[model samples]
Target: MQLLTTYMVRSQQKFATIFLISRGFTFQTMDFQGKYHIHCLMQLDLKFSLSFNSFTGNVPADLGSLRNLTKVTFSYNQLQTRPDGLSFVTDLTNCTKLQLLDFGHNKFKGEIPASIANFTNTLHILLLGSNQITGNIPPEIENLNGLQLLTIYNNSISGEIPYGIGKLRNLMDLSLWGNRISGPIPSSLGNATQLLKVQLQENHLEGNIPLSLGQCRQLLLLALSDNNLNDTIPKEVIGLSSLCIIFDVARNFLTGPLPLEVGNMSKIVDVDLSNNRLTGEIPTTLSQCLMLQYLDMAGNLFEGGIPPSLRTLNGLQYLNLSRNRLSGQIPIYFKNFTMLEMLDLSFNSLEGEVPQEGIFIDTKRISIIGNKELCGGIKELGLPACKVHNTKKRRKLPKLKVSITVTVLFFIMLTCLIVVVYWRRKSATRPSTALPTEERFLKVSYAELRQATDEFSPSNLIGQGSHSSVYRGILDGNQLVAVKVLNLRQKGALKSFLAECEALRNIRHRNLVNIITVCSSIDFTGAEFKALIYDLMQNGSLEQWLHSSENQSDMPKLTLIQRLDIAIDVAFALEYLHHHCQTSIIHGDLKPSNVLLDHDMVAHVCDFGLARFLCGSTNLDASQCQASSSGLKGTIGYIAPEYGLGSTSSLLGDMYSFGILLLETFTGITPTDVMFKDKWTLHQFVKAALLEGTKILDPSLLSSEHLAGINGGQSGDVDKVRLEEGVAAVLRIGVLCSEELPVERMDMVNALSELCAVREKFLRHGM
Candidate 1:
């Protein structure tokens, strides 16, 4: 490896003058000069590569002395800082052949030098992403006319994007997201007509989206969310017929009805126009986009019923119209969307009986919540009975006829009295009973569960974790349930077993898994144990969707908004357990595997076997003892460091676990994976990156399988951009939640609020 490095350096000196040896290559200063002199035979061809046996130190500044160098790739390995006073190799102007420069996925720091623009003659693709490069994007970058793909995302580039950016006429993809860039998006960018993809989200960019962008006829994807862009979406954008996906102008002050022309975009697929001030009814014309797959118009002012034509969209997989003013009955035509996997119509004013036929048969797929007038078909929502009222008036009987009937009855009563005495002796032989009152909960028998589970057949098991096995079963001959049989033997472990049962019984939240009943009895083997019965969550656990190797194409991969929603759901559930429950419940073990999802993909935190209830004087004593003892009580990677330091398990401990879960949700990697070794808490990982202005998690770490499932069968530029933005949003939320300082981390309310803000912004942008 060393000899190869030497030969390349010697060859570069004879051809290209400049060379950069990254990855800690070692060479004597005298030998380096000799090699450069030896290679000074022709036009210096700047070239360099790292060797495995290289010595570690700062990148040498002397390489800048070789002026005729271009094209450098020094990524990976453990190379440290570049030498002080050295920016771009000063000798590079002589070579003028530099085009592709990849310095990403490295530990480079300091401001991007102004001299970077010197490569304007030939530079095309500049990848400075995933680095510690700070400061504003240099105006000189506009000089690179040949530049096509410019990725400076995941940096600390501040200040407005230079208006001169329009000069890059050949630019195809520009990603400047995850920066501190502020101000309105430059309207001049519309001049870059060749641009196909543009990502400028997760920044401080503000003001109206430029209507001039309609000029970019070839544009396929555009994302400008998580900014302060304020203005109505331009109706003229519909002119971009080639546009397939758009998440423009989200989290902004935009307000207006959706342009009717949006329906004209026949090629468009996914649209996220949520969390905005947009008013007026959703245009029925949107139904014309037959290719539409995912539609999220939640947290908007869209009123009236959903468009009837939407039912014709058979390819639609996910639809969220939650937290809106939508009214009237849920359209019966929704049954036509058989391919739909998730439908959230919660917090609407819709009324009437929930549909019981077709897709509605899977109640979990439909979320008709916060609609006070809705009734029937579900016990979970406490729906009123669908009763028919008699509209016809009854005819009255004559009073004289009634008086004659009373006289006949008086004589009959005397005869009946004698008959009653004769029958009383016979009646005494019959069983006696008391009048029955209504019961709040049903008593399900253990034998019945065994029968429902087919005598605990392994084939019926849906999931098996460290604590229990969850099985899908039918109860009372009809109702479906999820039975979680505990691993503990009830005969010997009655105390701890009962404690868990009591904890689950007392805790109740819409987001927490509901415990329906408990079965505690001896099995055929005469071994007693307990099993918990809950409403069957057909969607399965979140871990399966995130990390399972099953055929998941049939399942809907969570969009950015959906992931945030689930994260917020889990956060709120934890908050309620810690603060609102009768006793503060510590979910000693909270991980993705324990978080179950219903058919709608709404998350429910399950598995409370290790839950610790803190209430009363006994709780205080236990707390003190736990605080003084060094013991860990959480998942391997998620447990807070303070816990090992003998700190009491407080709400903060749960927060730490939540942070890990958040990161896993974003990266789609398990905390226990080899990639996250070396005491690398997700919180610490994200925090360190943010402090250094670099991307915390590598996007490549996302499994190809998961990415394939998310983007499978999808083509066109818009679909790609939408998917990218969705991924970006998830990562942003993860970073925000995993901030090292608990105070810096957003609370559940604030996190949810911000999420809704992002949703509304997207809606206004007509994404």
Candidate 2:
């Protein structure tokens, strides 16, 4: 150790300039006076970038003696104290030539000392974000006249922004969001005309926007939302022609007519003025902003019809004028706005038929509700007709008696032709004997299905399950379909196959996979069976994406919110089956493998081979009695425990399966994996984790702590925060649906209400 120390000192003295170490090093307290008389040897260097590599002990203040040093970087390191604890780089002021400095992403704490002003002459970029720095921005910061970028976000800073901040004439980017800064925005900030991006949201600032901000002509993004700014939007803001992006003034107390001059910002792309008190008719001039793509004026007092001029905005993709007092007929010209993807005009007084052409034809993407007088072409809206009635007209008719003679002759010829045509078709296409509808499946010829599937080729197969295989096919001039062929003998096992067919034929739901038709036939070799056809799900089954190792690279990982969405969709399907069907249908098998996804990743339940329909007072014991089934009937891990005890399939079984699926979604782990066995089912795993605060689940699936910070809350306190009130409601439904006892669980209606509550919350929160 002594030899190494001697070598380091001898090297430091010879270099007298910058030095860098290629490997890790450690250090302890050193006596500056005894260290090679270091004060006079002004240029000292380190062998490695400073980091948390076991460098302990206090930062030596005597190191300031290196007056010739120009750069110092000590990020991610554990220095005991800032070299000058209560001051900012004061000891290094003697190093007048200092130009670059980086001390970020570390454990620096306490207020940034006002002495930071001493670097005013040379510092160009200052990044103190992502640290433990606290306290108010010192008024002395106005002295950093040469500073170009200042980012102090993600800290515990407090107090008002200094009014003299306007003095930073060279400042181009400033971000002080995600802090506790309070007080009115200083109008003097308008003096920083060179600023290109200004983010001051999520603060406690209150007051009207200063009119002088119009002077920031170069500003491209200005976010001041979620504050207490009041009064009308200053008209002077219209002068900022360089603003080409977001112009959000949501959630404020701003009132009065939206400025017509807003249309003059032709380059603007998005404008949000939601949750304000703005009144008056939407200005037609807004259509003049050709580049505008998103317009949200919801939760306001805007009135009158949607301006006809808006139809000219072919680039508009999202438009929301909901929760307003707007009145008048929907303009017929809306057909011209073909690019519109989302249109919400709910809770308005707008009247007239919703256009059936163009974007409105896609009813799923539009919401036009709460307008009592409004009528529409949408089938689900149940809107009344608006055609005017006229009841005073008369017409004369000519009598015809001779036509009967010609009609009688024509009927005789038609009857003979029908007889001959029917006989020929019956001989060529019909079967010798027709089975009763209740006992028969649609008779599609084996040859036709074989052609549709291109000779049952492996390349045409879309999916496969334990008891069946699914193939994609094009039948009858290009009608795409998925054919699920059950692996069962056709002639001898008619009863069992028919029962499965009857169960699926009777059920219907948007989220339950739709069966288009069925094929039953015998082939030339005397083999026969039944196959059900359904709409092809473009994305295939969820199980393949979630569990197949070979397909892992192709499958997209679902984010937390997407997983929550899929869970809700599956719950709705189960709820519908449990309550809305004429005779309750129990999808005896509910698992990710049975749930398919469409192009949008919307889940659809498929494969109803084990499904059973329950009639009133039916003997469930006999009805649910099955032939010897292998494995677990359903997927191994998702099968309800009661099913193993010979319990009749019930809604509770589906709930148990759904609970397992939910846990799988949250943990990104399959319930049947070996790692989750022996009292380690997903249900037990999640329950244990939440109960004991253990790290049993993958951390990547958890939302980051900083996400709460974006909404003006503490990162560490997020778990303590209640699930969003509406999400809490849905969660209650999930809890009720997954109750251990069958009788305690909620019926489909109640469960659906809970799920709808989540959608309501999203609508209310403008998500």
The per-model lDDT (C-alpha) reads 0.68, 0.68
> Mind giving the per-residue lDDT tens digits that candidate 2 earns over 218-250?
777777877777888876685365677878888
Model 2, position 86: C-alpha lDDT score: 31
Query: Using lDDT as the measure, which candidate wins?
Result: 1
TM-score top scorer: 1
Query: Residue 301 in candidate 2 has what lDDT?
Result: 94
Reference-based TM-score of each model: 0.46, 0.43
On a 0 to 100 scale, what is the lDDT of residue 231 in model 1? 66
For model 1, give the 10-residue run with minimal summed lDDT.
34-43
Give a tens-digit lDDT track for model 1, residues 1-767. Answer: 22223334342224222354334334334344322212222334456443222223445554544444456665443345556522643434444777777666555667777787777769887887766767888898899889999998887789889999998999999999899999889989999978888999889988888887887777778888778877688876753556677645556666888886675465677777778788888764465466778878888788988765565467888888999899988887777777889889999999888877656777678787798888876565568987777868666769998899999999899888988786676557643232211233457677878877767766467787565678766676345689988777333244445556756765678899977777778777787767888987766787877775533332345554566678878977987887776557777678888888886888999877666665342434565334323356667877766677766665656676787788787666677877666767565665565556554343542335434444343434564455456545555666665565556665555655665666665445333
